[model samples]
Target chain A: MALVEIKNVRKSFGALEVLKDVSLTVEEGEIVTIIGRSGSGKSTLLRCINGLEDIQDGEIRVEGQQVHGQMKKLRELRQKVGIVFQAFNLFPHLTVERNITLAPIRTGRVSKADARALAEKVLAQVGLSEKIDAYPEQLSGGQQQRVAIARCLAMSPDLMLFDEVTSALDPELVGEVLKVMEDMASRGMTMILVTHEMAFARDVATKIVFMHQGRVWEEGPPSELFSSPKTPELKSFIGSNH
Target chain B: MQNLNFQQVLRYQDEFLHGIVNTLEMTAIAAFFGLLIGVVGAVLVGSGPKPVRILVKAYIELIRNTPPLIQLFVIFFIFPSAGIRLAPFPAACVALSIYFGAYAIEIIRSGLASIPKSQVEAGECLGLTRFEVFRYVVLAPALRNIYPSITSQLILLLLGTSVASQIAAEELFHTATFVESRTFRSFEVYALISAIYVALVVASRVIFAIVGAVAFRWPVRR
Candidate 1:
């Protein structure tokens, strides 16, 4: 079964349709990259998958389970599908360790000591073990994003969503986050990334999807999509990226 | 022809002290209820549904627009005619709570609104229920941001306790009036009571400052 599936998903804000009949499937352990123009519903699609943005029609399924408006079911789905935002979104009041441990302790009902241990392990994986006691504001943007990834990882999610994760980082800081993501991708994690970094998308994604006007314009293996395009829209979008 | 008698002033010292104690008690009760009403009203007005928000706004505007003295009269004197006769202390407390609560709602609403949207979204995305979000994220930061305004309002309410005396509550200013009339030492009596009121305000300010420092240690310098 596909790890993540969006079946005829449609979303609108007031009168404007943001995502129109979008459908896709992501298999387990595959890296899927979604590339699009600024208003192409890429972020909205990611938000819909994570249950952050409610959909007006259709359904999303994660790990073969339907994701919908029910709180308990959505929370259970969220425990398996971790999402990281462009803004990092670490809790400012909590230390790095506490930020990583919050959900594991709260939702998972893990003991404080065990949660701390898991937090330390993930923090070390992200190369932020030394800054365990630091607050979000004290860390550089790259370090904060690393902590955010570690935070998601601590929940033991089966699928991870990265919505322009490197977009907010300094140019010099982008490489470290991409490197962490690359490492996660290599470890057989199913990830759907909404990104503008064409080169990274080309290199890391098993399949690349191009979105246009709230619809999937074209999708294929990265080599074919990035190099030779059958559609003029995909060709023009790639041209504009350079 | 000296009209002042020193012995009479000393003879009424016990009653004078009782009035001071009564004033402090009334102020304490009023401050407690005022803070409670203020916080709950602020939270309701700041976060509730549209109808509740409108109701809260209307209540705040109504209370703030009317004078507190008139409010005391309505509560103490006018209500009695309608068979709602509350004793002086309770009536004074209810009046002050409603009055100060309206102003506090405005102050704290501003604080609650000042918190960034991203912060709230971050908490929500982390799977925290709305109540937990308010308790841990919204209220703590909102209270910290509005601490100065709230403290000032509280001290002002303490001074406003004198208005309760007009309703025959027998607080500090009422005692001063009685003392002045009995001893014929108007200047000395008024001056002493004014000094004591200043001392009480100063003491409450110091205590509040210490509490603010301890409670909000995470946000502010120690």
Candidate 2:
């Protein structure tokens, strides 16, 4: 069984269709990078997988259990699958330590006494142990994004989703966040990433999924997708990114 | 101008003291209820079902559109005719709370609106329950965002307590009227009460600033 399975997922926004019968599977420990233009439904598809957005049609299952829109079911699914957003939406009122430990402590996954240790462990993983006492605004953009990843990592999720995480970062700041992601990939974390960084996709992605017009335009190893483009869309996409 | 005889106004020191105490007590009671109603109404208006939203909206509009004096008159005067008889003080508190709550809902709702959707989504993604998301992620920041406006409304509510005197609540304004009726020192009495109002406003602002510093101590840019 696949770690994540999205089948025939059709989502629409009122009069506009965002995702059209999108189907994909993510096996365990596979870093699947989804690259697409804005409005191509890549982000929408990722949101659907975690039940953040309801689907008009189709099924998304993780670890053999179907994702449902029920509050309890969505909470359970989210506990297993964590997502890092583009804006690094850290809780502004909370210190970094509180931001990372709020869920784990509230959900009874960790006790109050142990929450500090748990927060320390995750912050260290993202090389932000020094910022445990700082607020989100105190950190640089890259640092805040790292803290966001740490916040997700603190959940001990089986799968992590990155939704254009680096797209909002300054050019110089993007590499640090990608470095943390690279570290996660090396440690065998299953990740589905929607990103514009083709180089990072080529380096870290086990398989690349190119999306166009709300469809997977191509799916192959990075070398195949880059070296031998089968479609004009993919060809132009790769060419333009260069 | 003739000499201001503050010495004669000061002859009614006990009356002035009682007035100050009553005014403070009424403001405190009304503030507590107003804060409660404002927060709950804001949440309901923002996320409650259509019917509930409409009901809360109606309440807010009704209170906001009408003058508090009229509302107080209805609660104090009309409610008695309908078999619900509240004394002068309780009636004033209720009227003031309802009045302050309406504007507070608008102020707090704007604060809640200022919180971006992405921030709430981040909390939901972490598996925080809906209430937990509001409490931990959204509440403090939203409150902080509108702290100044809410506090200003509170000061206005404090001043609005003067309206309660019309119902014979014997708060500051009513006490002043009684003093003036007896002493005929209208200028001195009015001047003294105005100074007290200024002092009260300034003192409350200081208190709010201290509370805000402690509650929202996170290193936000604002």
Candidate 3:
């Protein structure tokens, strides 16, 4: 079974329909890159997968378990899926260590010592093992984003979602965040990301999905999709990225 | 002004001290309850279900719209007639708490609102339940951000305690009236109590500053 699957998803913000009949699937260890223009419903779909946003119509399943409206079930699914945002929404009032351990410890998933150990582990993974005591505001944007990723990794999530994680970083800082994500992708983590970094997506994505007008316009292995575009929108989108 | 006589006012020194103590006690207790009500009411109004939220909104509106004096009258006079026999002191405390709680609700709601939406979303994405998110991430920063406003409200409530004298609570102002009636030292007694109220306000502000500093020693920036 696919690690992440969406079936006939429909979402709208009152009168404006953002996602109209969206569907996709990701097998375990698949790195799916979703590339689209700003309003292509890429981030909304990511939010729905984690049950952050309620769907008007459709089904989302993670690891073959249906994700829906039940609070407990959504939480259970959330434990397996982690999402990092473009804003790097670290709890500014908390230390890097507290930010990472809060969820695991507060939810009683692990003891404080274990959570501390997990924080250390993930921080090391993100190359920020020494910055555990720093506050979010004190860190550079790339470091904060990396902490957010480390914060998510502390939960030991089976799947990770990155919603334009590097979009908010400075051009100089983008490389560091992308490097962290590239490392995660190399480690066989099943991941879906919405990114404008075409080069990084070209190199790391096992599957590249081109979204246009709130639907998947073209999707396949990155090799086939990039070398032989099937849709004019995909061709133009790819052209514009260069 | 006529010649001032400190000696006459000093004769009621014990009474003045007693009143000042009473005033401090009433303000402390009422402020505690008022802060509690404000925090709880703010949380409920911000996140409670539609019906309860509406009820909270109504209560805040009702309390805020009417005069504090009227609210005191209802609590002190009407409630007893309705068989809820509260003593003058307790009634004064309750009245001030509910009255100030309305303003507190508004103050704290704006404080809570000042918290970025990203903070709440981060907490939610971390799988925290609704209440837990509010308690840890949202409430801490919200309270911190609004501490200055809340402190001002608290001091204002403390000053507003002068109105409790109408119910014969015998706090500082009431004692001043009693002393003035006995000694005919109207200006002196009133002036003394006014100075004492100022001191109390200053003292309470220092206390709140200490609390704001200590309680929020943790790292929370807006």
RMSD of each: 3.1, 1.4, 1.7
lDDT of 2 by residue, A1-242 (tens): 99998899889999888888888999999999999889999999988888878989989998988886578978877887989999899998899999999999988899999999999999999999999999999999999999999999999999999999998889999989999999999999999999999999999999999999888889999989989999999999888899
> What do the candidate models score in CA lDDT, each in turn?
0.86, 0.92, 0.89
Ten-residue region with minimum lDDT total, candidate 3 chain B: B213-222
Tens-digit lDDT string for candidate 2 (B1-222): 478789999999899889989999999999899989999999999999999999999999999999999999999999999999999999999999999889989999999999999888999899989999999999998999999999998899889999999989989999999999999999999999999899999999999999999998887774
Best by lDDT: 2
Candidate 1 scores an iRMS of 3.1
Which ranges of candidate 1 are over 4 A from the true structure? Answer: B1-24, B47-50, B81-83, B219-222
Q: How close is candidate 3 to the true structure, as a TM-score?
A: 0.96
lDDT of 1 at B135: 68
Roughly what TM-score does model 1 have, to 2 decimal places? 0.89
Best prediction by DockQ: 2
Give the DockQ (2 decimals) of all models.
Answer: 0.33, 0.76, 0.58
Residues B70-94, candidate 3, lDDT per residue (tens digit)? 9999998899888999989999999
Indicate which candidate wins on TM-score.
2
**Considering only N, C-alpha and C atoms within 3 Å, which residue pairs clash in candidate 3?**
A93-B219, A93-B220
Please identify model 3 stretches exceeding 4 Å from their true place: B217-222
Could you give me the TM-score of model 2 versus the true structure?
A: 0.97
User: Is model 3 an incorrect, acceptable, medium or high docking prediction?
Assistant: medium
Off by over 4 Å in 2: B1-3
